[model samples]
Target: MSDTSALPRPLLEPPAPQPNPGASGPWTGLRTFATAPFRARAWKEFAYLIIVFVLGCLATAYLFVMVGGSLYLSVLVIGVPVLAAVILGGRVWGRIYRVLGTVLLNAELPEPPPFTFRPGPIGWLRSAFTDRTSWRALLFLLLEAALGMVVGYLVLMVVALTALVTVSPVLWAWKDPHNVDARGVSHHSMVQFGDYYIETWPRVLAFAAIGVLGCFLLPWLFRGVCFLHRVLAAWLLTPTRRDRALTELRESRRAAVDDATATLRRLERDLHDGTQARLVGIAMALGRAEERIATGGDAEELIAQARTSSKEALTELRELVRGIHPPALDLGLGPALETLAARCAIPVELRVLLPVRPSPAIEAIAYFSVAELLTNVVKHAAANRIWVAVLPTGSDALAVSVRDNGQGGALQPADASGEAVVAGGLSGLAQRARGVDGSLFVDSPVGGPTVVTLVLPLAGPQ
Candidate 1:
């Protein structure tokens, strides 16, 4: 790929406009309020709220009875199975709630952990005793049942209030006009506020206007309530911080180990096919040359051919050694990185401000890391400038940064494909760094300028 380092850096573009599903414009606030009660979404949410409230009340009572009974009956052998059944039942309901939340509330709840079966009776008991997932699910079920009733009721009330106010004028008009009090005035109004009544046309209009105002505020109010519920569900439903961290660590460790194994296999294959093959050819050529000399034939031609094979073998050996560990790294990281910079497709401004040198392994890692990062910039980032820096981190580490003025946007996104598209380019680098107790951080916003920083401990991999 061509490195357009001579080209000038482009101006950063403004952020693209995001699509908004709600109302817009100067009068959007009033328009939303006036039309809130009529919106299909509002009605749908109200219907969902009603369903949840009734179901939650039933569920709350049932779970409370079942769980309470189970705890009381724990002294009996039947209690153990009963409690286990309740927990397992809770997980089933938890999954159902997750689906409901996704459809009704648009909350993307994470998948709960899988239930693992154990082999013997003792093993089964142990599994049940240590089932964190089941316990969490039961807890969420209890919380959802108890809180769902209150939150769902509040949501319904908000919708009902808006609907009532919206139809106040028509409701008052339909009231029995002949009904009157001792003052000869109608006791009922379109809508009643304590003793006050909205009976007159002007008053009805004003009350309807207030209803319209309520309608506009409904969406936001509804969202606020839903947001609280979503947060609660997320906290109670998703994996905890420790679980997530451990998961990440396990993945990284697996990646690193797999990468190392792959690399070793690749190296073995390369040697067998390249350097070793060339050495075998050279040996055969020399043997022929020796045979020619003894037989008093034209040995000069054979010797020359053998010499060419030997040179080729040497070249292959050098390339293989370089792949294993760059010879430039023996001098130090600074010179090694400079050699890498010199070979980059783009103009890389190299800076090394290391007061101390790290171990050989650390130097090799720094070298290859810079090499790969620069390669990415040259190939992927259509940039005009690149800066590479390697600096010592005080007493016990090394920091390497690669910055480019490119059309950035290389950060990983939430991809449901579970494919390694994001992990393809920089993930290997990250895994390699992790192998040495190091980290790789990328800051590439969707415009220009991409910065990738790698940090390693001086003591090297533990």
Candidate 2:
């Protein structure tokens, strides 16, 4: 009989999107460390540390055994120098470990103390000895060495035990070896099973199974030791708060520089297109008017030339002013983009979905990006159809995209090509789009179709 109540029921609505906690900073580091490749690389480093530690311990033990109590005298003579060397070595090792850990674990490590101008190598060595981090790393190394020794002994013991157990039946059957009884007695005979002796195949199979089980557990035991190594590494390799802050500051500065360069290029392009071009046109018109009067042409002809030149100058001046700041943008990006799309040579489809207008700066960048993208499409793309989409991206930004169905292959060359060329008209547009803290990316193949996307920060209505 079917039980309707026992069956699971579907929800009426889809579940809301869960927030990603590890997408930002430090948590991201931890998440990266947990991935398979990073974990494997960390284990490789741990293995190398174990090897170095074992060698160091062996050397130390050899020196101690040879000198005995006189080792104290040797320490008094060489102890200071050895300690200094170990500390210096630790500093160097710590720096290398820091770089490796950052790459593998994506976590920052404590910054090494600033270097000072020391008189000689000895002075520099003394400074390294005084550094607290150097001492800590040395202590860590020593602990690792001790732990490695213990683990090595345990591994040997397990191997020996497994070997002995696996061979016990053979030893008893072939050599007739004496064995310990439950009572305080030694016997040279083997126990008999039903139809066979205990030292037979059945007993041998039992011992082999136990040995195989122990062998299988060996990797788990090694993993536990490796986990301890990870703990030590995490403690000694994580960066100090100050270093992390400095790193963030450097990244921010780089982003700002890129933004500034983009802005400068946009300003340069506007000056060239607006003020410079207008001045040039005015100069040409005035030259023609002067030539007409100087040639002793009729008064009506000269007057007519003057009037045409004056009208052209006025038009150029208005265009120059518009280039500096377009009034279309004040109407909002939707209307501005609509006006742009209407002017495109190719058919354009624009999609805009936003409840509120973005900031003026964001709008300007978006508008210019779309304008440049359409210009490229009309000039070189040979596109029959174009699509532009604008939408609010989450709560913090606006997204804009232009797509075209044309012969693609629009990538900028390494030296100079396509829209990225310095002399290319679209270069100014690309620069304008990059200004005002926006990113531009193009995906175009050789056959057909191209898509350009831009993302800009959105503050609020101007």
Candidate 3:
């Protein structure tokens, strides 16, 4: 059989399905936010929010009372300053609202409208006055502050009561000295327990039970408060559609620019080091050959060496060109990756299920990332088996992962040295991933299997 005909058949074939290019979906912050415990946590957040609100109000009121003595003093002198302070305070408060909203609501808040100015300091002042978002933000702050005071007061009462109830047994013991049911009475002279209404097992059991119940109920109450906080935060913080779209557009443009710059630099380097150098060496070899013709024996040997060198250089140049941009990428990532997996030293099981074609840049990154990881595995991992998978994570992203059964304890060189180390071209691979606004993580840990995962954003407004 011919050498080509004798080659082994591929273990897995690439899927025909192409991923959609213009698909998009909501950015559901984090998966943890969908859980029941997260909801419970959200409630606790509400309680904290109320507590903060109440404290703010009290502090503001106290400041007004202490610094602004009479109504006239407050209105004329202190009022303007206070109002200015409130406006400044509100701006600061908006940040707090955003943080809390993200934590509890797990939603992106609408950004305030952009500031525009006509010309000078007055222009700036007028711009601030004209800005609808600034006004809305200020209004949100004032409302939150007022509500916070009420919530804070309520929270304080609940907390105080909860604490008191929790310690009721101890207080009752101290007051009566005999554990009495001193209900509706200011001071009970004798401490009663059980039948005697003095220190007894029944009274002790009752006190213990009350303490346990209080402990259990306290957390639930706190959770309710947190829920309310989330509701308020969501209402105050969710960003407008226009703002979200603009932010996404900016991010996409930045990613594209980064990718383009990286590609240009890589292409320049390849041409300089690979093709350019090889052609120069070939020219030098040819010149040496023409000069050495007088010494026929030496000329023959040098010619043979030069001819071999030229062939090797040609091969390397072709490979360098292929590495820069594979023609198979246009066919689709699955086929490209399948070709890579088939060429590996160890057995590779590849599974690709993508219904839509991702952005060319993203697909290229994913393919190359998998290719590099597999190459590393074959060269260094010493594994018998490898698994590669590419799957759609969402409408706008795809998750690619490679796993191998080999010696573990593999870490990114930068992480291992506490400074970036250019080890085995790993840095280059990482930079390429980052260039596409993607992330790569390797988990090796000692003595076994290693898993590498890369998440690339797909085509569309992310």
TM-score of each: 0.77, 0.48, 0.52
Clashes of 1: 3
- Candidate 2 per-residue C-alpha lDDT over 139-250 given as tens digits, one digit per residue, 9 for 90 to 100: 6556655665666556557757876666667766788865465564665535434433454467766866787666545545555665565566567645455655555455
Clashing pairs in 1: 32-216, 33-215, 33-216
> Which candidate would rank higher by TM-score, 1 or 3?
1
- Give the deviation of candidate 2 from the true structure as CA RMSD: 12.6
lDDT (10s digit) by residue, model 3, range 370-426: 877887887767789999888877677777878889875454233755442224445
Candidate that beats the other on TM-score, 1 or 2, i.e. the better one: 1
The residue-by-residue lDDT of candidate 1 on 33-91, one tens digit each, is 67776787665555556666786887787687988898778889889878777776767
Ranking by lDDT: 1, 3, 2
lDDT of each: 0.74, 0.61, 0.62
Best by lDDT: 1
Cα lDDT, model 3, residue 271:
78
The superposed Cα distance between candidate 2 and the true structure at residue 22, in angstroms, equals 33
